[model samples]
Target: MSHHIVLRVVAKLLIPLILLFALYVQFHGDFGPGGGFQAGVIFAAALILYALVFGLDSARRVISPDLLRVLMASGVLLYGGVGVASLLLGGHFLDYSVLASDPVAGQHLGILLVELGVGITVTSTMLSLFYGFAGRGGDG
Candidate 1:
């Protein structure tokens, strides 16, 4: 891999742009073409590319398996917590109108939170799978 200086440099350059595009898609989803799911998959793809170029151990050092697993669950919890919060606020489960003083604002807030949760879960899940399969050679 040390001989592959071009690959390393190119990947280093591209990874940040990939992450930025993913974020763009994540935030712009509500009003435009992309959304949480697309953003998450893109995010995972960047990480996978990093793993492919630098090797799995480096990626793992950046985000350990134990921590990724927790993050995966945390996304689900954040989504569920939002629903529960809505319920506690006197709305039905997942009903977004109660999340803020203005119903429209509440809806926007709820949707953003839900999208964030979806993004987190999808990203972590994809990264975990990539990590598991990429290390089948026991490299990591």
Candidate 2:
């Protein structure tokens, strides 16, 4: 890859665009077809592509495994915390209507937060899997 100048250049150019598109999918999910799962996969794909082009070690440096683990747990906590908050607000678990004074606003905010959590978890999990497979040392 170090010798593949053209490939390197192209990857550098495309990675940012890929990241931007993933963000678009994440934020626009509330109104359109894309959502947390789709955005998460897309985001992971970009990092994987970077790994493929730049090398796994480089990708690891970009995002450490420890950080990924933290992110994985944090995402779940965020999702669960939202549910708990709703419960404490005198609503059933995951009842977004009680998340805020305005039902519509609460719905919007709740969905956005839940989707964000999903996106974070999926992205980290996918990256962790990629790192595991790529880090393996064996002759096949």
Residue-wise C-alpha lDDT for candidate 1, range 22-131, written one tens digit per residue: 99999999999988899999999999999889989899998888988998999899899999999999999999999999999999999999999999999999999988
TM-score of each: 0.97, 0.96
How accurate locally is residue 20 in candidate 1, as Cα lDDT from 0 to 100?
A: 98
Q: Which one is best on TM-score?
A: 1
Give the clash count for each candidate. Answer: 0, 0
> Candidate 2: lDDT of 97?
95
Worst ten-residue run, lDDT, model 1?
131-140
Q: TM-score for model 1? A: 0.97
Model 2, runs deviating above 4 Å: 138-140
The count of residue-pair clashes in candidate 2 stands at: 0
